[model samples]
Target: MTSGGRIEITGLTKRFGSFVAVDDLTFTVEPGRITGFLGPNGAGKTTTLRMLLGLVSPTSGSATIDGTAYQDLADPLGTVGAALEATNFHPGRSGRDHLRVLATAAGIPIARVDEMLEMTGIPAFARRRAGTYSLGMRQRLALAAALLGDPGVLILDEPANGLDPEGIHWLRGFLRHLSTDQHKTILVSSHLLQEVEQTVDDVVIIANGVLVKQGAMADMRGGGGAVVRTPDPARLSEALAGRGLTATPGSDGELVVGTEDLRLVGEAAHEAGLPVWQLSRKAADLEELFLELTSGTNRNLGPGPTEGVA
Candidate 1:
């Protein structure tokens, strides 16, 4: 039997007055997987999430968690947990108290509050007022509140914001554990593509409030430029270009060469007598592919509704 958490968005659209924030978006997030939701600023990602969480009404169509609308779920907070913003907590409330209030409101056990604080690594600081918490600490408190119900589905937007490197590493492992061990369905919206590439099992890309691409992370591999880490990236770029390959700046101080053939990168380095440190075809083309797909469509791709409808 299926473990149950599955998100289905069908022909979903949202409009703010005359502006089309999300248009005809459709995708599925399966159980036991981490799906990355990516789009540029003003891409309607926030609008869609709001509609899905029932915080805002959709202009048309539907967004459902576990095949039921979020508001219609027998236990809305218990079935779907969303941590959209870290700054929403009350400044006067302690972390433990904030979670306890949510738990009490949802009829969830009080014990889950402490468990979530411990699970999110904020138990020691649980008694501190939220106003004293750092941005990262607020983020952890928000996450602890989201998990207080032990929800089957998680929706996180920019979850890595304000997280240090060590915290990020912990989150990565923690999310993977949630998906793999607990079979929870997760949708993470992030502008940090490299971190998304490392953490997500699938990706759903959108632009101008429209679905652009969606697929398994594995499918994004294979046909990609080689991402090379070298001591001399300028020289390496020149070498790769001399071999008739175009090179571009990639994430993390790496040079991306346009060619799927692994030998081409190796040969170019060997020909230039340059010592190569690392080379791989994994996720090398994601940035390029994302830009290629959303380039001209990111800003006001098309008109929507009647102007000044609000």
Candidate 2:
């Protein structure tokens, strides 16, 4: 595959006995950009990644790499590089040996192993046993293994699991380089919404085994909401109620104004003579937006999740 290979997941579904883990999921990840796979715990993010990698059999549907299943690809390692879990390496083997083993199995160049070690900043300690490494070191080793083939696409699940702030910053820049400079397709899964916001250009969110939203991050912020903080909570609540808006008390003395315009909310506070401590329009936070869509309660208040790719 070329550096601009694309990934397509079509109607993907997986079941274990009677329980359905993933259901009718469909989306595409384009090359030259990073796409974030986001969802809450038990939202089937791992299951979906496993299916895409052909590690697990899907009950129905399939995911493809450059129009073919991973097993059917001419050179799987050269086409798609993946790091699904942090502690997948053998404890007894040296970091360099671990990568060497995979490189041998994949028929990749042995020199690439050392290059990956150097690239991931683990070359100095490459001779040490992987079992002796710290969690952050293990994560770096895993990333090194993924880069061994210099593949056209990368599918990583929570790659920042054990990274420090500096490591996370390094990873963000590295992945961006993989996409922008190398023109590779990159799909990464994470529950860290803020991190994703900082790193990814596009996002695909799933919840309850369904697609919540998928689109460019810029379009997401266009759907706005307001955050209101008030001194007289009771009067503000009454004012909001009169205007057909709902208000739920949030942490501290702030209120999470659900489905209320900022100007109208300010107008209500002014008319009621309630002192407003804070009132401003908030650009939609993907994490908060995900909750509002899949949690069910937020839907009853107003027009819930944006129609298509919110």
Candidate 3:
């Protein structure tokens, strides 16, 4: 666990035939914290990450770990650990066997297999064949395999893809511990907003193969946009507009004040003599912000695919 090393990508572009998968993308993953890689399905997040891991050749630009490409590193496994997909496992191999095989390939110690299994809490089923294991079990095994070399940085793509709620919860805590306590630099990608919200300290948002924004979650959320709920919605809206504050109608006639100062909203309601049903400030949750940034909207219809459900 290394607390902080810099991963810098500059003008990184990848093209598949005429289709540009990634368009001059650039970002950094700081050590000692999780950096989330987010985008819509066609946003090229997976392609960018693959390039970062040396799995794909970029048509232009570059991704570097400590200013060096992953392939150029002497010991690439020691530099980065990755869990790209759950289906990357061999069906005939046992959980422990799978880790052992990768550890051998990486020149890691055989003992690391048991150690990772124990640490990941999958030792009880370590001897179970991988194909027979449930989705949750496969996720754990994949994670264990990634940790085989005890690399300083981790690159994971949709690690929570098939996990149950409890498994997702476990992974969230585990990743945080690896970054905070173990000091591993982690870059994880996922479409699950709630899980990413719980796990990451920073976020890099992308849409339609283009970079949208990237920064600490606190900074983004604190930059003057928050929801303000009130009992007298109509009166509050009028009061806010009078005071030069931007307020919008949220679902069910709730007033959402898109301003920084919570006090301003409160004072306006009080000055207008409106009843304070509720004046609590609400930051857009990760899910809300994700949709807003990716889909460019905040309307939640149902759990179904949309124009760009990435």
Candidate 4:
């Protein structure tokens, strides 16, 4: 069985004419973990993926899998699988035929085609023309083709774009199976913040082709603040502000303190002589962190779980 590889992007930069598509970006995708690649529109996420796949050349720096560049890999298809665009399949070709063609080109066994079809849950409609299939079905077909070689590293971009809720749920479970059960390295880029929040074990966020943050999902969530409900919300807010903590207002007269330290809130409330009815760690919010990281500049977002793959 093939083994997964760590993805290392080192000071990668891409230039199209005068505009910079990717800046001096660097990050890593750990093996056996699903890493979410997130960025706003025109943030050079596609460019970074293209460079990593060797589809586009980097103006400077390099992207490597297990220290070997994609072009230099002994078995490219068997080592790295990517589905950047699900719509790249031929409209007239059957889904099974598409995988077969890819298998033949990659020198993979034709038997793997059926296996992938079954794995992707497209065996029932495998013979149907890709043009006749819905967007979600096409996504499944594309995924089947990508898995034909059983590559250790999987890269997907916006794979959930056309998926229904059920499809998305299945995708989450499928990716998890690949990562945990098979120990495959998966890097998925998607705009669905909520879905990304739920799916990925780690995240790499970029803005203007620059890396803004990258770390474990748990660390990101763990850095989140705590919620509190005090009778004197303003006084509590002022008290927290004096300690260099921001207290944002949440719904139903709740105070969202900017620290994960529950004891800090308790002590502050106690000192203020305020009756603290409730105080607890707020829910993990990847969206809020993402927005805050990408808002003003592409610079690193202050301090927190922004350190992982150095």
lDDT of each: 0.83, 0.82, 0.79, 0.85
Deviation in Å, model 4, residue 230 alpha carbon: 5.4
TM-score for each predicted model, relative to the true structure: 0.79, 0.77, 0.85, 0.87
TM-score of 4: 0.87
Cα distance off (Å), candidate 4, residue 24? 1.0
lDDT (Cα) of model 4: 0.85
Model 1, 73-181: lDDT tens digits are 9977778888998988789999999998888888988998888898999989999999999888888888888777788898998888899998899889988988898
Greater-TM-score candidate between 1 and 2: 1
lDDT for 93 (candidate 4): 92
Error of 4 at 80 (Å): 0.3
Candidate closest to the true structure, highest TM-score? 4
Error of 3 at 198 (Å): 1.7
> On a 0 to 100 scale, what is the lDDT of residue 29 in model 4?
94
Candidate 4 Cα errors over 4 Å, as ranges: 230-249, 267-277, 298-310
Model 2 deviation from the true structure expressed as Cα RMSD, one decimal place = 7.5
lDDT of 3 by residue, 106-212 (tens): 88899989999998889999888888988778878888888887888888888888889888888989998898898888998876566687778999988766788
Error of 4 at 297 (Å): 3.5
| Location of the lowest summed lDDT over 10 successive residues in candidate 3 | 300-309
Rank all candidate structures by their lDDT, best first, as comma-separated numbers. Answer: 4, 1, 2, 3
Q: Which ten residues in a row have the lowest lDDT in candidate 4?
A: 301-310
Per-residue lDDT of model 4, residues 1-310, tens digit only: 5558999999997766556677898999998899999888667787889889998889999999999999999989889989888888889999889888888888888999999988888889988999999989988888887788889999998888789999999999999999998999999986556777889999998887788888888888886689999999999998888788899898899999988899988888898999999999987776887888877664332232221111
* Candidate 1 CA-lDDT value: 0.83
